[model samples]
Target: MKILACYSIKGGVGKTATAVNLAYWAARSNYRTLLLDLDSQGASSFYFRIKAPAKKNLGKRFLQAYGQLASQIKESDFPHLDVIPAHLSFRNFDILLEDLGKRKNRLRQALKGLKKEYDLIILDCPPTISRLAENIFNAADIVLVPVIPTTLSERTFEQLLQFFKQQDLSRSKLVPFFTMADARKQLHRETAIAMRKRYKNFLQHAIPQSTDVEKMGKYRTPIDLFARNTQANRAYYALWRELEPQLKKA
Candidate 1:
């Protein structure tokens, strides 16, 4: 199974939306997909109209064994898609990870049991740099970060790069894409051009600021179902098409 994570040190960068939509595209392509919400706020679960898991202690259960984590999985509305709703207890992940000591691959080790069940696992990660983040970095085959084409976003992305360097992690697997971009804005357009020139690994697709994406809060489902013909929807599909080969190799 290929493990993909939506991760960024800064929140409100459209990471959750990117995760949700891409998982939808994967499942729609007939892949057995699992979207795991690891954020304490449970925005991913909320977006899917799913209630938080009653177990509430994902960290505790994750440490126990794969059985507990497997038991927590729920079926999503879309076909071929499954979800593991977030739990409030996930707030203790930093502490829990710290207590694990030298288990370098704790998350990846626990997830091995799912290899037979899922073709793809999309993790909607919490925004933070901690021990838990280290586990995620070790677990994922690729980390997808949503970067708004702005100075603040670029700074954080650089910080993430610096962190990756310090940890001796491979930066090649990181795919940074522009989100909430508006071509009408000169600053946005210039930033995109500059980023593309500076980072050869950057994705070509960009999700423009769309009214349809904002409406996801009201529909509680991927915008593709409601706005399939829209530009934003097309951009999302283009993104998956580009990543399809990479995912296959993974």
Candidate 2:
């Protein structure tokens, strides 16, 4: 399976939204997709209307019963897409990961059994640069870095690049995309131009800021499903098209 991790060091940049929409599009295109909500806040799980299991020590339970992760897949109702919901238990998962001493590969080891079951596995990562995030980088085939057209977002992009440079990875697999963009803003226009000039070949499609995107969480549906005629839907469709060539090769 091809693993795509939608991530950002900073929050509120639409990483979860991108993951949800892309997974939905992948399923709609006839691919068997799996959306793994890795964020502790459970926002992605909430967006998909999946209820997270209640328990304070559930992350510990998960690690102890790692083999059961696959069994949980049978409970989801989306035809071609399955979801692994996140729970509040993950708030303490980081501490457990640290105590385990090999935290960087914890997620990688947990996901090895699922490689053959999905055509595309999208990870909705938490907004942090922890060992869990590094594990995601190590496991992902392609890392889609979402950046807003702002100075703070640009700084995060640079930090991402620096992080990648320190790791052993295929640099060509790093794809950058603009998220929550307002084209009419001078800062947005300037930032986009600068990003294109610096990372021309690695840049993917840009997703403009729209209310439709924000509403995906409220509707508990993807933009493609909720408002197909809107600009947001078209943008996500274009992103899927752009991603097709790379996905097919996997």
**Clashing pairs in model 2, backbone N/Cα/C closer than 3 A:** none
Instruction: Judge candidate 2 against the unseen true structure and give its global Cα lDDT, from 0 to 1.
Output: 0.81
Give the candidate number with the greatest TM-score. 1
TM-scores of the models, in the order given:
0.97, 0.92
Candidate 2 RMSD to the real structure: 1.9
- Candidate 2 per-residue lDDT, tens place, 54-117, comes to 5467676666565767755533456798998987777776788777787577777777778788
* Tens digit per residue, CA lDDT, model 1, 1-250: 9999999999987888888999999999999999999998888888888898565566777765999889888899999999988889998988887787767688898888999999999999999988888889899998988899998999999999999999999998788999999999998999899989998888888899988888888889998988889998899899888887887876
**Full-model lDDT, candidate 1:** 0.88
Stretches of candidate 2 off by over 4 Å are 74-77
- Per-model lDDT: 0.88, 0.81
Name the candidate that leads on lDDT.
1
